[model samples]
Target: MYAALTSLHWVYLLFIILIIGVMVLRRDTTLVCIIGIFLLGLIATSSLTTALTGVFSSLIYAITQLLGTILVISIIVSLSHIMTHTGINEVMISPFTRLIKTPNHAFWIIGLLMMVVSFFFWPSPAIALLGVVLLPVALRVGLPALGAAIAMNLFGHGIALSGDYVIQGAPKLTADAAGIPVDQVIQASIPLVIVMGLVTTITAFIFMKRDMKRGILTVTSTDLQHFDEQMNQRKAPLSKGLRLFFAVLIPILLILDVVGMIIFHLQGGDATALIGGTIIFILMAISLTAYKNKGLEKITDYLINGFQFGFKVFGPVIPIAAFFYMGDAGFIDVFGKTLPAHSQGIVNDLGNALAHIAPVNTEVATATLTVVGVITGLDGSGFSGISLAGSIAHLFSATLGEGIATLTALGQLAGIWVGGGTLVPWALIPAAAICNVDAFELARRNLIPVIFGLIVTTIVAMFLV
Candidate 1:
């Protein structure tokens, strides 16, 4: 494995460590990521011009990868703006408000619903679908926006995505890599996933409640007020009948979207596109109903506002996403196969190297698998590195002669928990943007609970192994 690595690999590893350090210090990593991409291009191709060009290419690649998410979020926000302005949002959330009467009720209900939807539809679409409806309810009930974001991130991205039971995509990936039956891996993951999910969410909720009590974090009604102001600015508000009609029609349409996704087997980008397209139609209906002849122009205005907010939120994420993309397939795409012949991409190669460095034992193997999962997940894609986790689990299980299923599940859990979205600012953008909270701040708040969850989960894995 060491023999397979090159100067390019080591340089990439060094930058990964550096970037993690910067992030741990709560510093902006855009500049750092940009420099890392440049240097990696410089090292891989040894051409100054190529290095500079790679920076631009990488950003484009990241944007392309992220474009679907950005578009869905923009459309959702645009629809939300219209809903708020038409006084329809109030009606939409009124039912949920009754059930979610307190902050605690808001957190648990939103989180559990997010997790269930994410299990089938995946987190991106789940966030888009539920965020608009449930978020305002959560906020009105005194759950801060950040807390709402955290619930969606943890349960949707962290737990549902990690286990991936309904879709079985995650389990299949790890199971195949570990050379075991998918059922084995799935069965093995059950306890670990439950432990991880409970520990992390309960811990996060406790911390949030503590902060709220201390007044360090408090609910602000500004978002509701802003929407009220927007509604007042409208020359002619939608009739109460119209508002009630759309409020009823929208949820039914969204539920049908979910049914369409299930019947058509849409997931990920396909699932998100379904939701986005539905939102656009709904947005059109409301805009036309509310503004009459001016509706055509208002449609453009709403879209513009949505896109503006979308790009503004995504602007900072692009550079860092670009840099991380280079660690995987983006390297070959941006640099034209500059990696060494034997390299399994920079991230996978680094993971392999780490696997070789550690000695064999239940404890060592368990710890190493968790660490490798974290390292591979540094690219901010939990799925991108999970195959590596499976491969590494295979290597260790071969040495240990037992616990292959448990190890595979452990690695899968760690990778997805970190890169799936909970701790990755860019990856968690759906939750952050939907909840109208800062992505980085959401990541910061999630850091402790996720870390704690991983530590506890690793110990459990060690014993199970």
Candidate 2:
């Protein structure tokens, strides 16, 4: 039984390596991941029908797991789209342009603003809120669009989403999978999150400065120019009074939402639901006030557009996520009664095997968990592999004793940093699209800082653990 389980674990690892290989080659891994699910099911259950059904079942499971994130993103996007029509979106950020008189200023302001906003509203909505309004300012101030993209991607996706301190989505997932309290995961992640954020953001800023000194900090693309022109094409039909009212009112409302979270101690889904509820109300108010009698029609249009964007972004991720989800013990219900009764999950089994086969020490455990987190992130959905990370962290903790939270936090950080948006092209789309730069190029730019941050963070994690 042990040998068979270990062999199955090796198969899972083999598929993970293959997925990463394809991603490194700049190829899509959706098909490869689907095949992996089928093969794993076939080997585990010894039934072709089970394997085939598992493919569909896994996809459904992945979608179900991701639906909340998808809905929140869609609603936020819809809100952003509505605000754009009223020109309030532009009004909302125009004040920041004054501070961005230089490339360095633009980088810091954009990056910092994105981080804060993403922490509250998530990167997807935050990108939609800031991209059109800030990209032009950053460009005019001598920051290359690519640099601006890097700033947003690094700060928002890498920092805010990785730690997920405010909303606690990442920690919730990791903690739940690890069978630990969410607060424990969040507490353990704080220092590592700061370290990772500071190291990566500072490194990126340095790179941007160097690029600027070399006279390479220019956006020469006509596409960017076109995008800017299109953004500016919509005029603020509202009076200055109205625009100013909303500009101040909107921030206050969002800030209040943050305050509510803090006062009520809401975390994870509750916090997200709060933000989502606020955005919906904001969307309704904007549609009704701006579009008048046409408000209903306009709101529907925005929602449809938002859902379209949301699903489009999520489409390629589903199959890839499905494969990784199977490696988590939490999804056994999703896969029905097919899984072996004693199976702890492929990733958990791997961790157990590694613990027994090797000298289980802090460094080895830390490295293995980090690597597993990184591997799970290959699907380009950082949250998908976190449960696996949590499960494996639990297994390793049992062997090593103590520091489960620290190891789990480390795995969470690694998974999110790689797969969240910085290192993956598909995941970087919101930031890239907003900045009017190539997602692949943005990923390339973020690679060095993120990897270095991960290494430094892992070392720090060893000490903490």
Candidate 3:
């Protein structure tokens, strides 16, 4: 049952506004988030001691909610490192190089492969897996390094990560915040993801081709030298035969995980566990084989590398996540049942209040969420703001009386497409570095296409909502 709004609810709304304002200015929200959490605890419990402890407690709760995602990502990155060092990744990706005979061939092939691989692992690791092996082939075929970076950024970071169908990390955060099922958000994202991916990538390809014709885009000697240097750095300790065997074996094992997910109907944490388990074993086996007696030491080294990456990526996210989690089920988890009886969480209570005072239409709700998502993404973490989007989507959806999953998916797409790596200069570094292109240039080339795609996708989401 719904209850009337209280100071707790208004305080949450005020902090949400402040967080959005900070994000729009492209500033860090961690301090703002910590203060918000402390204030929320203060208001709910009226105890300075409880409020102080609540900050740490909320972070623990957020981490508990997010640990599965962090672990799976860490494991995948660890496995990627081992595969790269042993030359298994190159062997796996080398066959795709045969498909690139021309510039057009290179763009689509590299993009499609990146998207598919990114779906299972992650865009960052997928970039490493495909970049070194394919960059030379793409360059030989006349595709500019900037063009390759755009393709990878749009396809892998933009498309695969926005949908995140297999990994479900993005959806899990949004869905939990929205008080909806993860599968519902994933299903709702399919059509929007397709539209956004097609429009953005095709528009980018056209612009790239036009630039080439105008002599504005060309393969550079510097890019080739960079690629050569990276290639030279990779000397696999494993024999050619061993590399080939593992390369073939790895894909089959990854495919089996997909098949297992479908057969067992696993989703969310279970699906991630399935993949994480497989990758851990893969890392151990490869480390043992590649290092012989030194295998045990190498496995720890790879995992440490992975955990470092995982924590680095997630560090900025935890505080914001902790603050937003309080809007939903996390409130009671962090601070006891401090609300009045019948309160349906802070976000829902605010939504119910807004519904009674001023009815919200679908168009306004859709546009508001798109703006909020884009603004939140401006902070450059893509993920740092999605939980906020989910909370706001839930609030608005409650007023509309429907379409929570669609709104959540739309917000997820907008935030990730903007900050996940495509439009953000800093976020684009990995693909830009790998392709030997300037990150700012890649972001510039991506701007028009991504904006057009977001506009189209927003309109499509309005209809779906």
Candidate 4:
């Protein structure tokens, strides 16, 4: 027998379709679009009851799912704040800028710095730190604020986030949905990440160079002024001896943490906490010794701001997440009164439908999931769309069987890599906001890089995963 449909199902379907349209055409915020979806959910679920209770429940459910993603973002942003206040953030980038005097040279260096720091701290913090440090240099050289934002988005959010080698947030979420070890997802994701990273980065560079050649871009004087203001806010310099010591000391310490993980077999959320904690500690030490009396105050202030930024970024996403979270059986444990062990989950059902259709190739499935992710991201919340892709993968992989987790990971990559801010104009807010660029234009510009990246990722997945 087929599963019974509620009027609410049709309503949600329509809501989602319209929301996707708004994202593509109007580029509305995900939360704002979800307001329509939520209203529909209320109308459908209430029917005669006018029961407001169901509406509240759906809202609560969606918000909770985004909490974890938001929490991770919060911690990273908070750490960036601490680093900024402690002056470690600038210290991290100073040596690199000294090495690259021109925008042409600055592109690779900034890209490299954005990639590395983002892998450790994640993208939000990386952008904040880099915006304060390198954005001005790029803008000053006539790189244009839009160009700077694109560069940051490509290397930081697209590359570093896609792989998630250090922070590992994306993999953990994918792994949980698949009932696979995080290591499996991480390892399987490596080749796909490399392929996507190369294709995406190269594509971005070509566009940037073309923009530079046409004289359509200029560096942002605002960024440089912001940098100066923040630098003045610091007011005290670290002793050359102390600065040199922490510079070498912090990298070595983080390296040891990585080594420890491999040797000791740490993975999943444990590893995320370990790496994140270490970064915070290193910043703490630098702050205490360098800032002296101001250390505690400034560092704590940074932490508060970081967490605040994180929460704001992810806040709207939480409700959208609740709806997607319903697609995963793993979440039913926490989300409902009860769910059966043998019950089919939303992701599983969707995947099973795709799997049962024998003519559909793996590449087709991958592409479909990416499209779903791109559509979901329009709601302006990346994490909200994750579970939908995860659910679809779970269903499809059960039929594939050979590398179910990897397929799931592949779908996870597509969902996050795109929805996380590559395509949807609304989701690109952070980079857009910092660069003082138009989020919609940023999204439009990303269409090429992201679509190209997905094409490469799909081909790589067909071979690698």
**Model number with the top lDDT:** 3
Question: 271-357 in candidate 3: lDDT tens per residue?
Answer: 999999998998999999999999999999999999999988988889999998999889899988567778888999999999999
Best first by lDDT, ranked: 3, 2, 1, 4
lDDT of 4 at 67: 47
Q: Under the 3 Å rule for N, CA and C atoms, how many clashes does model 3 have?
A: 0
Residues 306-402, candidate 2, lDDT per residue (tens digit)? 8997787667667766776777653465445444446666665666666677768999889987887787677687765666677678778866768
Clashes of each: 0, 0, 0, 16
Candidate 4 yields a Cα-based lDDT of 0.65
Where does candidate 1 stray beyond 4 Å?
1-3, 100-197, 200-236, 360-465
List lDDT for all candidates, in order: 0.78, 0.79, 0.92, 0.65
Q: Model 4, range 275-320, lDDT digits (tens) per residue?
A: 7677677657766786789889867776677678766765655554
Supply candidate 4's per-residue lDDT for 7.
Answer: 47
Ranked by lDDT, the better of candidates 3 and 4 is 3
Q: Clashing pairs in model 3?
A: none
- Which stretches of model 3 miss by more than 4 angstroms? none
Arranged by TM-score, best first: 3, 2, 4, 1
